[model samples]
Target: MTLSLFSQFSSPSLLGIPLIIAALTLPWLLLSLPSGRWLNSRMTTLHEWFIARFTNQLFLPLSIKGHKWAPLFASLMLFLFSLNMLGLLPYTFTPTTQLSLNLAIAIPLWLATVLIGLRNQPTHTFGHFLPEGTPTLLIPVLIIIENISLIIRPIALGVRLTANLTAGHLLIHLVSSAVFTLLPSMTSIAVLTAILLFLLTLLEVAVAMIQAYVFVLLLSLYLQENC
Candidate 1:
C-alpha cells in the first residue's frame, strides 16, 4: 500500500532507457495538426483560439523586441499544460514532478534571458544589480542581495513547480487510499470521503493547469525584463 503511493513517482524504465522521454513526447502527439485547406476542424479552431489568447496575454507586457519570444513561450505553455493534465490520469507518472526535469527546462531559459540582457544592453543589465537610490552605505549589501536573487530565479522556478505538483499528488494519493480503506469497514464515511475526493480531484485539475501557466508566465516576465 505504501509502495503504491510512493511508487507512482518512481521513474519508469525499460532495458536501461527511461520511459520519461516517451511521456514528454506523448503530449505533443495529441495536439491538433495544422491543415492546408481554408477551413479547419473544430479541434484545430479551438487550438488556434487558445494559442492566440495565451500569446496575447503572455506577451502583452513585454517590449517590441520580446515579440520574437511568442512562438517559444506559446509552445512551452501548451507543452507544460498537457504534461500537467496528463499526469492526473491513473498509472501515469508526471515528468514535471521531477525537480531535475523542471530545472533542466528552467536553467537554460533563465540563462538565455540574462544573456540577452547583458548582450543587448550591457550597462543597463549590470545597473540592475544596484538600484538608483542614494544610499552610499547600503550599496554593497544591496548589490549582493540583488545578485543572489538573480542567480536564484531558475532554482526557484524549478522548486516551485516540483513542490506544488508533489504536494497535490501526495494529497490525492492519501485521500484515495482512505476512500478505499474505509469502503469495507465504514461505508457511510467512505461515501463522504468519496465525495470529498471527487471535489479534490477537480481542484487538483485546476491546480495542474494553473501551475503550468504560472511556470510559463514567469518565464515570459523574465524575458520581458531582459527585452
Candidate 2:
C-alpha cells in the first residue's frame, strides 16, 4: 500500500484540524475570564518576580506608558503549545501539523515583532533590517538579503513546525498500521508499537513546549535587537 502524506487528515471530521483547535481553545477562553481575577492576584507572587523582570524587558515598547501586553502574549503561547501537544495523541488531529494553521500563527508572530519594533523605534526599526556595520558600498546587497531573510522567517517557522509534526505522526502511524496488518495474529507486535507510540507522544509534548518557547524567545530577541 502506498503511504499518503495526509492520511491522517482523511480521518473523521470531529478529530480534524479545525475542530481540534476549537476544542483546545474553547476551554481556555471560557476559563480565562474567571481565571483572570485569580491570575491577576497571583501575579504578585515571588514566583512571578523573574517573569515580571523578563516581561519588562520584552514588553518595554508596550510598557512605556504603563501598558503591558505580556499577559495576552503569554496566553497565546499557552494555547498554541497545548494545541500542539494535542496533535501527538492517537486518532487526534494536530492543527499545527497543517501548514495553513502554522502559517496563520507564525505570520501574526512575525508581524507583532515588526509592529513592536516600529512602535519602539520607527526610524531604527527599518534601518535594523539593513545590516548594522556593513559598508555603504554593499548596502544594496545587504538590504536585498536581509529583506528576503526577514520575509522568510514566518514561512520557515510554519514549515518547520508543520513538517516535524506531520512527519513524526506519519512515521508512528505507519509503524502501528504495519504491525496491525502484518501480525494480525500476534497481539504482542501491535502492543509493542503502541508502547513506542506512547513514548513518542511524551517526546512530542516536550517538543511542543520547546517550540512555543523558541518562537516567543526569538520574537523577544528580535524586539531587543530592533529596539
Candidate 3:
C-alpha cells in the first residue's frame, strides 16, 4: 500500500498521474464556463454527433435539453464511467482505482455539492447540514457529527474504489499463481488457470461498473439534497 502510494505521486507533473486527474476534471471546467447554455445548443449537438461517429458512444442516451449543466455533466460521468470500466480489460490499468485519483475526483465533487447548495439556498446553506427538526439540546452534537460525516464522504469514496480494485486484482493474481504452482509443467492446468483468470476478469468488470455507479449515485444524491 505504501509503495503504491509513493508510485502514484512520484510523477509530480500533470502529464502522468495528474493527467488522470485532469481527464476527470477538464469536463467540469468546460461545463462551468457556459452557464449550462452552450452545451445544449445545436452546435454542441452536432459536435457530439460527429464525435460519436468516431469515438465510442459514451454520452447519455436520453435527451438533455435546456439544462445547461446536463450535457457537460453527462459527458464527465460517461468519461469517468468508461475509464473505470476499462480497467477490467486485460493488461489495462484503471486510473480511478487508485486512492489518489479517486480522491482527486471526489474532493471536487464534495466542494461542488457545498457550493451548489450554498448558491441555491444561501440562507439555508448551513441549515442543510442539519436536519430541519431536531431537539435544541442535540443541535450542536448533530451539527458536529453531520459535518464530520460530510467531510468523510470523499475519503470514503477514495478508499472504497482503491480497496475494491486492488483486492480483486490481488485475488485473481493469487489464484493464478496457485494454479501455476500446482501444475508447473501441465498445459492443461495452465489453460484452466487462464480460463479462471478470464472469468474473474469479467467479474471484476462488473464490480468496476458497480463502483463507478455507486460513486455517481452518491454524488447525485448529494447534489439533489443540496439543490
Candidate 4:
C-alpha cells in the first residue's frame, strides 16, 4: 500500500518529533562497557581486541603526528559498523542511508584535515597542488585540477556511503517484493527467488560491514595526508 518505495528512508517520528537521535544512539546500547574486574565478558574482550588491532594497523604507515587520530578513527569505525549491522534487521532504519547525515559527518572531518594540513604545514600542503616538474605551461591547469579534486573529496565520501547503502536496500526490497508477488501463482520459481533473496541478504550484510570499513579507511588516509 506504500505509494513510494523511497518512503522507507524517511525518518520515523514520535509526537511530531523525529527519532534521529534515538536511531543514532541505538548502537551504543549494544556495546558493553569495560569493568574494573580482572576478566571481561567475551564481547567486551573481543571489542577491545578488534579496536586495538584496527587502530594499530590503520595508522602504522602514517607519521607520528597521525598517531593522534587513532582514537577518533577507531571510535568512528565502531559506530559506523554498529549502525550498518543494525540496519540489516527488520523494521530498522540506516542513518547512513541519508545523504544529509553522511555529508554532515564527512564535510567537517574532511575540512578539518585540510585545515590542519594548511595550518601545520602550509608549504608542504601547497606542494600537493603541483608536483616538481618543468611544465611551466601546464601549471595553472594542473593546479586547478588538483584543487578541484581536493575539494571533491568530502562530497565523494558522503555520496559513496549514501549510494552504496541506498542501492543495496533498494535491491533487497525489489527482490523481496518479487518473491511475494510470485509466491501464490508460481511456487517453484518463487522458492528459487526466495533462495536468491537469502543469498543477497547475506551479501548485503557483507556490504554493510565493508562500506563502513571503507568509509573509515578513506578518512584515515585523509588524516594520514594531513598529519
Candidate 5:
C-alpha cells in the first residue's frame, strides 16, 4: 500500500534500464517536424506558428544579444511543457518532479546566464551585489544579503518546480485512492470525490502548462537581466 501510494514518483525501470531515458526522449519524437515540401500539413503549420509566437513573446523584452538564445529558450520551453503535460497521463513518470533532474536543468542554464553576464560585462554583473545610495554600515550587510539571494535563484527554481508537481501528484493520488476506497461502500460520497478528482485533474493540467511556462519565463527574465 505504501509503495503503491508513493510509486508515482519512483523512476520506472525495465530489467536494469531506467525508463526515464525513454520519457525524456519521447516528447521530442512526438513533436511533428516540418518536411521539405512546399506545402505544410495543418498540424505542422500550427506547430510552427505556436513556436514562432512563443519565441516572439518571450524574447520581445530582451536586447539583440539575447535574441540569439531564442532557439534554446523555445526548445527548452517546449521540452518542459511536453514533459509536464505528458506526465499527467496514467502510468507515466514526471521527470520534473525529481529534484535532481530539476536542479540539473536549472543550474546549468542559470550558470550560463550568469557566466554570460560576467564574461560580457563583469563590472555590471558585480555591481548587482551592491546597490547605489547605501549607507556605510549597511553596505556589508546588504551585500551579503544580495549575494545570498543571487546564489539562491537556481535552487529556488528547482525547488519551486519539484514542490508544486510533487504536491499536486500526491493530492491526486490520495484523492483517487479515497474515491476507490469509498466507492465500494459509500456511493454518494464516492461520487462527490470523483467529481472533485475531475476538477483537480483539470487544475493539474493547467498547473502542468503554467509551471513549464513559468520556468522558461524566469530563465528568460534572468537572461534579460544579464543581457
Candidate 6:
C-alpha cells in the first residue's frame, strides 16, 4: 500500500516515450498568444493584466539593471504556475514533483545570479563570504559556512518544491483511498472523510500556487542581490 501510494510520483510513459516530456511542454502549447487586434478577448485581457501586475510587483524592488530579467522571470513563474495547477487534475502527472526536474530549473537560474554577481561585482560577490567586524579566529569558519550556505541554495529550492508537491499528493491519495474503503461499511464516516478530502484538495490547490510563486520570488531576490 505504501509503495502504491508513492508509485504515483513515477514518470508515466506510453510506447517507450516518457509522458513527462508532454507534461512539461503541453502548458506552453496550450497558452494563447496575443492577437494583433484593436480589441482583445476577455481572457486575453485578464491574462495581460495579470502578467503586467506580476511583472510590476516582481521588479519593483530590483534596480534598473535587474529590470531586464522581467520577461524571463515572468515566463518562468507562469510556466511553473501552470504546471502546478494542471497537475491537480485527475490522471495527470506533475513533472515538478520530481526532484530532478526541479533541480534542473533551479540550478541554472541560481548559478546565473551567482555568475552575474561575479562578473559585474567581483569584490561585492566575494565579500558576501565574510562579513565585516569578524574576529580573525572565526573568519575562516564563517567563510566556509557561508560558502556551504551559498551552495545549498539551489538544492534547497529543488527539495522544497519537490517535497511540498509530493507530500500534498500523497496525503490526498491516502485520504481518498480511505474514503473508498470506508464507503463499504460506514456510510457516515465515509461521507465525513469525503468532506475532509474536498477541503484538503482545496488546500493542495493553494499550496501548488504558493510554491510556484515562492520559487520565482526567491530567484528574483537572488537577482536583486547580484544586480
Go through the candidates in order and give the C-alpha RMSD of each one to the true structure.
Answer: 1.3, 5.0, 7.7, 1.4, 1.2, 0.8
Query: Across residues 1-227, which tens digit of lDDT does each residue of candidate 1 receive?
Result: 77877787889998999999999999999999998989999999999999999999888889999999899988988999999999999988899999999999999999999999998988989888887984999998999999999999999999999999988999998999899999999999999999999999999899988998998999998988888
Tell me, by lDDT, which candidate is best: 6
Error of 2 at 111 (Å): 1.6
For model 5, residues 41-147, the per-residue Cα lDDT tens digits are 99899889988999999999999999999989888988999999998899889999999999999999999999999999999998998888889999999899988
lDDT score of residue 112 within candidate 5: 98
lDDT score for candidate 5 against the true structure: 0.92
The 10-residue segment of model 4 with minimum total lDDT is 1-10
lDDT of 4 by residue, 72-141 (tens): 8888888988988888889988898999999999999999899999999899999999999839999999
The runs of at least 3 residues in candidate 3 whose Cα sits more than 4 Å from the true structure, single-residue gaps closed, are 1-67, 185-195
lDDT of 4 at 146: 96
Instruction: Point out the higher-scoring one by lDDT: 2 or 6.
Output: 6
What is candidate 2's lDDT per residue for 1-227, written digit by digit as tens?
44465667543355444465465565365332324454554434532664566566557664343234577656656666767766665656677777887788878877877877778678887886675788998999888888898899889888887777776777777776766775677778778877887787677677777776666666655545554
The candidate with the higher lDDT, 1 or 6, is: 6
Q: Which scores better on TM-score, 1 or 3?
A: 1
- The 10 consecutive residues of candidate 1 with the worst lDDT sum are 1-10
List the candidate 6 regions with Cα displacement exceeding 4 Å: none
Between candidates 2 and 5, name the one with more favorable TM-score.
Answer: 5
Q: What lDDT is obtained when candidate 3 is compared to the true structure? A: 0.66
Which residue pairs does candidate 4 place in steric collision?
Answer: none
The residue-by-residue lDDT of candidate 3 on 51-133, one tens digit each, is: 46422333233223213345444555556667766555555556765688779888998788778777877777787567887
Lowest summed lDDT over 10 consecutive residues: which window, candidate 2?
30-39
Highest TM-score: give the candidate number: 6
Q: What clash count does candidate 4 reach?
A: 0
Q: State residue 1's C-alpha deviation in candidate 3, in Å.
A: 12
Candidate 3 colliding pairs: 36-68
